[model samples]
Target: MAQNTDGGNPFAEPGELDNPFQDPAVIQHRPSPQYATLDVYNPFETREPPSAYEPPAPAPLPPPSAPSQSSRKLSPTEPKNYGSYSSQASAAAATAELLKKQEELNRKAEELDRRERELQHAALGGKATRQNNWPPLPSFCPVQPCFFQDISMEIPQEFQKTVSTMYYLWMCSTLALLLNFLACLASFCVETNNGTGFGLSILWIILFTPCSFVCWYRPMYKAFRSDSSFNFFVFFFIFFAQDVLFVLQAIGIPGWGFSGWISALVVLRTNTAVAVIMLLVALLFTGIAVLGIVMLKRIHSLYRRTGASFQKAQQEFAAGVFSNPAVRTAAANAATGAAENAFRAP
Candidate 1:
């Protein structure tokens, strides 16, 4: 056995030192820092007694039982199930929640319905329903079909029938004029006279119908409706001129109507039947001219009662023509073009 030079482990045997894989129980325990078990040093004081560290009191022992039962772990806040039969308290709470939701939905539905009805009323433009008390319009119009709605606003209640009668007479006049055109055509074919009169008469009828309605009837309607001095004067001026033209057409002057004076003379020279027909046609034209004069006079008298004058008509005409947006725009463009052309000139 060899002695160690440095202080050696007293418990370690010479054979054990050679064999480190040997069981450690054979070696004596040493108080070295590398292999020490450290105790925690807490600065704070604890309420637990020294006995508490002596090992927890053996967990309360279960009571002796003949048979064992299974136990379930439960959370403190977990809700208990009522199985098939729900508790009355829970049922009442759920019903209250459902009722609140249903009431909210009902209120919303009522608000939506009210808004829908208001929208419908506004969209209909105040006239919510039809008022069909008045008599219906005639089935057919001889000259041109007139929309009752167009004139209904303008015409007075008492004078509505008078206006209707005037329209009927106008239709008759249109028919008479058409007949005169046909007569002129027949006379030209028979006598071989120049067709200038026939052509002019056709032109006159074609131009006059729409022009007369626009110039006379419209102004007359407006005058009566508004009791406007300007409108009445315009109606009177146009209508008087229209009546004069009618009288001239009825006269059958040299270049007027082929079927008028010339046709009458030729027919008188030839066949009695033809002459009678031509005379009747000429008489119809004369009657229409006379009717026009009478209607003009009647309307003029009514206008005079309203105190309309030529001065007011001139002012209205000037305002209507100059104040129009289209007229202003046209005038502006013309001025611009004229200026540009003058600037460009050599």
Candidate 2:
């Protein structure tokens, strides 16, 4: 072998001098130096070897996230949807107001209808032509009803309850009278000497039932219905008399006719059952007397509040008398007769 120009081992294998680690096939498969730098193992830094796969193109660089509603800020140029929420609230409020107005209109319409009906009813003969419904007589009964008693129609709203209470009290009084009659009958059966009480009880029921309806009840009703001072005075007078009668009845004067406390106690020695019945009737009468007093006071208070007076009552009476056609004619006839008599005398 020729001596080498550069210093070399002459005894070394020829392939060793030409780089024994190099192979043509291996070199063809090996990656380039730049790609090999990507595979360098460093303890402090990490790297992945690049291959023909190209690392799946770095996972497409995950898309950026949008900002949350709380984090996002609005600009003046970008209009907010606040108008939509405000309009919804305003629409709801308007709907509620409209409903309230509609309800008021409905109430007014009902009131108008009621007034129209009243006007129509009153159109005939300058008075209401409706049939009397009070006394509640049957269709087949020969006796027709006498009055038209509608508290709602005749009395003011403030007085309706008081009038209704009075009506109920009257009904209670009638029932109490009926019960007294039965009690007196029982007493009479127990003692033959009690016949006077039984007879008087029947008379009391028959006499007082219609009389009470006419005297105090009717006057009070008329007082409230027309606010008549005269009617109020009449009620006070008659009701005072009624209260006296109630006291007398409750006293139970024997033989004078009432199943009262005295009669009940007297009969207790003779018969316990009769005594008990008379006692209950006496209690009923006593209750009526007390209720009468309370009702009188209530009515007096109501009267005072109404500004009614004796002068008003006199004026009402005078107006009523003068307005009567029969009274006017009689007065005119008397005046003409007096004038003729005076002329004749002269």
Candidate 3:
């Protein structure tokens, strides 16, 4: 009972009924993929169609699993979202690195700016460079849109005017001191028939003049040079000491070298008239000094505000302009063009 008579024929080209395993150590060899390259065939070139083999289809999904379940399969032709995930992650990391670098650069810039400001302060004797706030505003601007919007209704702060209230008042006081000295000379002339005689007090006026000039003027000049609030404060205190000395002198109080002097004796003897006049001058100076104090406070506030403004501008500039790659590229292009044009220009 044979399905075919091929077993009885040895040279029958081996019928389909033949047992391939019965061949003595011989087997049919598969067409190896090593012989394939781009579906080409030749001794030097062998290829196969790229579409010859396909990855298995995912088994028919079991009847829709519960909404909580999901599938994880890697079928050929299915996009590997991993690539997208990696790209997104790489982009995020690069952006973070860029931001960190930008922030670091901003920090360095701010530090440099602060150091420069400190150098300026030290060079100028620690005064703020900005001018005084003064000339109080009207309750409202006459025009609908005031040209000077940033300036307040309560104070004036024109950037160019360097004189503060204290400087102005000190200048006036210095002028008054000079006038008083001149008047004393005139009074001395009126008293001495020969205009050559010197009073015991003439020497005191001469001494006081230089001391007052030094006490206030030097510091005011330094304040102007530095434009600093710290210098103003120092100047105010030192000048206050000078003012106190004047008050004591005017009241004929004893003990500042002239306290027990022949000048004090003469001053006390004429205290009623001279003391009253000196007290009037002192009161006027007091009022001006109070005005200066107000201006100093206002300027200090503005100084702090300017620093804050610089910081804000730095942050916004870094975020909007410097951090943008497109902007950087454009800036680079512009710089290159400018350099090339400059070089070409004879």
- Each model's number of backbone clashes? 0, 0, 13
Q: What is the lDDT of candidate 1?
A: 0.66
lDDT of 3 by residue, 73-124 (tens): 6579976664567898998899999999998888667656655765775688
Given candidate 2, what's the lDDT at residue 254? 92
| Rank order (by lDDT, best first) | 2, 1, 3
lDDT of each: 0.66, 0.85, 0.50
The TM-score that candidate 3 achieves is 0.27
Q: Give me the displacement of residue 201 in model 3, in angstroms.
A: 5.7
lDDT value for model 2: 0.85
Q: Residue 221 deviation, candidate 1, in Å? A: 2.3
Best by TM-score: 2
**Candidate 2: 10-residue stretch with minimal lDDT:** 47-56
Candidate 2, 97-156: lDDT as tens digits: 999999888866765765666677888644548888879989999999888787866676
* TM-scores for every candidate against the unseen true structure: 0.49, 0.68, 0.27
